[model samples]
Target: MTDAPTLHFGVFEVAAPQVGGTFSWAHPRSRSADFLDPQHWIHIARVLEDSGFDFLFFAGGYGYPLVDGDLPEIAATKGINFSAIDPDYLIPVLAQHTDTLGFVVTLSTGLEHPAQLARRLASLDHLTSGRVGWNIVTGASQNAVADVFGQDAIVPHDTRYAMAAEYVELAARLWEHGWDDDARVVDRESGVYARRDGVRPVVFEGEHYRSRGYFGAPPSPQRTPVLFQAGTSPAGRAFAARNSECVFVQATTPARTAAAVADIRALAAERGRDPRGMKLMAGLTVFVGETEEEARRYEAEFDAMQTDEIVASLYAGNTGIDLLALDPDKTLHQVLGQGSVGEMGTSNIDRFLGENAPTVREILDQLKGRGTRGFRLVGDGTQVADGIERLAAETDLDGFLIEPVFEPADLEDFGRLVMPILRERGRLREGAPGNTLRARLTEQPGNDRLGDAHPVLAAD
Candidate 1:
């Protein structure tokens, strides 16, 4: 029999009261209201670490879904995607309590300067003991970005990727080349803290960004903190192939995901990168129970919390299309022909426009919870593991980023019910104490640093 493929696991979270489902906070079992308490996050980190999760991935950006320059009723009143605190501040505290778990925090290339962003990330690497990763994003919604950040003009879609390419290059240079590995001497007898010759300024000039000065910090472990990118558009895919160590994709279907996976690997090969070096993780949500019937019951309960009206409004803010105002029976093809989608999320829109174009009502039901987009499995522990194994095999995916339907309870259930089954099958990594986040995620034993093939290490 062929050996089972090893898969990494992570939790997809936002720093908010509710993440995956609308009104998920209303669930009797949910403790999402405790998000503000440091203990809440600390308990979560401990649970995940004990459960053998590879990392905690925080989804972030400044933009909320807006329609006609106003927040939708569900978004405004129910706090759907509205109460996000910056996960950056919360990481240090979580790091203090956990020993092996990694944290990947999202920061936009659109909002912060590359130099400052690099410094902050490097500091996080040090604080977390090299258990840090960065989810680099070009703002998904340009209108929302402009509204929230008070920008005078919107940067076009492709142009944002262009700027991100420049931004990432500069930041990587600072992380990889600014200071020599042995630069810090701390020679008390000689009164020389660092070797002056070992440190040098990283002078970079590009169309979108420029930097001239030595990086403010010395090298941390895994100097370039595992670079992660989540764009699946053409420009986004190209960017991921060139720069990302891990790529996050939201799966539309098994066949489509397989195609995307092949395309990304092919793109990497064309760029002179080892195709296997890039890890692709898809967003997946699992509803598990002791029996299949119980699992279905749980799924139905969550589904019942969604209302068509609220979901329709939330979809409008995400896609820049007011679907609620349209004919309920109109097909997505008809809707798309009516107007340009402009700068909102094309990825979400494309999901509905597939071969079997869904109607407005169908679209609303599918998007009942904003982040609940990918493959959703409802089953008992063994059955759920089988589904995950099959999905990974079919799609050539490296891992799954679990989107919790309810915060701590959902995670606890997965850990208690499903994790052991996978572990016994040798489908998950064994304990690797003292491993850097990169090493853990990539399953590269003892090597915490980026490989020689990475663009960041290429000679200028």
Candidate 2:
């Protein structure tokens, strides 16, 4: 592997809006309402692929985001596209349109059967020619349990991760050991279609799940899809160390991101794996324009599209904390105490509170003005590139998971304006390289299968 401080890039998008308001779709110059159209995503895939992005990561959840404790306002106003459509259906279409771009689709381990998830992901890997990644998430919203799964209540956070641990282990066995390397012998000469010994049945009985059958499909190019985990709690970190190939993290500053990366790498080492094996990708939102003033203008426009109530509601949905009910004068520490809303959301709020100790009202103002929960980089092409370079250098991050503001236009602008600067600085890959998602992200061409350090292989 190369030791060069080269940077990688990916986009963080939801299948639909997760909030109750709109920005890009409301812009006078934007035609973003066609976001639901397959053509829109196809165009986006091509733009990102041509720009040499490593992947397009999709975020998802089950139920509508609540406003305070009610969902009426969000639903009536069409606030966010709370779980609009499945990325599983979208990835294949995107695959057909783009040759080099990787597709990372989120799947919650808390809701699906392991065997079914394994089969679906394996088929996607085949369809994408090994360019598929699975973002493993343990469901956070209690509404998902009731609305999506017909369950009564949400599973406890730590318990959900515990179940996910077993779920992934079972799925890994199906992916890794279900079929031999040469299981698919299409020889038509002898009357023998295949060897019975090549395919093996996987019988697993875990605390939360049980399965007994051979994997239905043969191994694809990557054998197992690239594993991505997005959680920052202690249990979540432990899970990532054992199973994740790429980790999605959110931090307000490069220093905080560096600390998170350091901790994850150390955890990986403790688990008998190479510290660098797990790639840390910080979540960021970018607003790019031809000039700094123009970019700031765009940022202001987007920021204005959001209101304090909508911002607080989104925050409440993420962390299970009702900011609307909070005392405006109380510090976050005094209000939140030890209870966590969700792994990723709670971590971010805690980081912000620890750093700034902003009161509830101040926090709401920050959220309203920022337009995103993570770091927001707003500038012209050169300025954005400089920020990216500095972030990579200071944090030793593998890359960023960019959350775009204006569906196609924002990304298109980045490609046309910002990418050339990044290329000139030798920060981005020069060409497509035509490889699997795992190989592309890790920069280790031809090594498509899971490494020996993974817990799945240890189970062998």
Q: What C-alpha lDDT values do all the predictions have?
A: 0.83, 0.77
Runs in model 1 deviating more than 4 A are 333-340, 354-356, 369-372, 457-460
TM-score of each: 0.95, 0.93
**Backbone clash total, candidate 1:** 0
Candidate 1 lDDT by residue in tens digits, 34-126: 788889899889899998899999887777766776877778777766767888999999999999999999998978889999999999999
lDDT of 2 at 350: 68
Question: Clashing residue pairs, candidate 2?
Answer: 17-81, 19-79, 19-80, 20-79, 20-80, 21-79
Q: Among all windows of ten consecutive residues in candidate 1, which has the lowest summed lDDT?
A: 335-344
Off by over 4 Å in 2: 1-4, 17-23, 67-69, 75-78, 81-83, 333-345, 352-356, 369-372, 430-434
